[model samples]
Target: MIKGIYETHIQVSNLEDAIQFYTQVLGLTIGQLDEARRIAFLYMPGGNKTSMLGLWEQTHDLQTRHFAFHCDKDFILHGATEFLQQNNRHPYNFLNDRSSQPMVFCWMPALAIYFDDPDGNQLEFLALLGGESRADLGVLSYADWLRHTTTA
Candidate 1:
């Protein structure tokens, strides 16, 4: 079996804002400040803590766009609660086909939520359901999507 993800790096529009959201809002531990490299890595929950995220200060427009977090439902609500209480702002807002509530959304077998950083980059948190895991989840082929929509 695979050990875990080494890390996930994301370029941020503003490093300061990203830092605030992660450290203050989400309560993630911070690492060494490498201002010269314009990069910072954030860790996740687990034994080995192999899952980590990296934020890079963006000097230009972001190239790769989407980023996500896999967390528990209670953990997400707790984190989102703290985020709103701290910043007076909700993270997840439905860009399209979204509801008008904060920290609440549905997607497949995963309960998903979303929000943005100061630079307007989209962020997501997905709470996997019981007996469900991302291991079985993966890129969908066009044929699969077509079959899924059929009224059989």
Candidate 2:
């Protein structure tokens, strides 16, 4: 049976720059590198071998991709948002709205903040809210989500 996502690959124009982004900015650990083949492997935080991200240098134009890292704590997500902002990086919503705040996904009861890498790959930090499943409350803006969660 399938357990969970193990790894994913994406194309990059440059390996060294991509390495810096994934490692320094996104906080992934360097796993392996093949300078000859222009391939780089990145591991998620906490040294989890199960999840990996592969960056392959390609000369051809590659389509941008979107991915998310699931987090379990609200503070971490919030802190990530702040960190990104402090670095002059902006965060956006699923709608591609750059509002500098986290969005509330009522369907998943999750709070998420979205941003993009240098290659324009959309990345997210998300956490489930309330610690339980609930009704689908639909997508909401950061302010609205805060109000709803507090008053619900």
**Per-model C-alpha RMSD:** 7.1, 2.3
Top-lDDT candidate index: 2
For candidate 1, lDDT tens digit of each residue in 5-25?
Answer: 677777887787788888776
Tens digits of per-residue lDDT, candidate 2, 1-152, equal 99989999988887899999888887899899999999999999887587999999987887788788888665544587688877567877666764666777777778787888777778888887773443465787756766766786
**Clashing residue pairs found in predicted model 2:** none
Mark the regions of model 2 whose C-alpha exceeds 4 Å error after superposition: 131-136, 142-152
Give the worst 10-residue stretch by lDDT in candidate 1: 98-107
lDDT of each: 0.60, 0.79
Q: How far is candidate 2 from the true structure (C-alpha RMSD, Å)?
A: 2.3
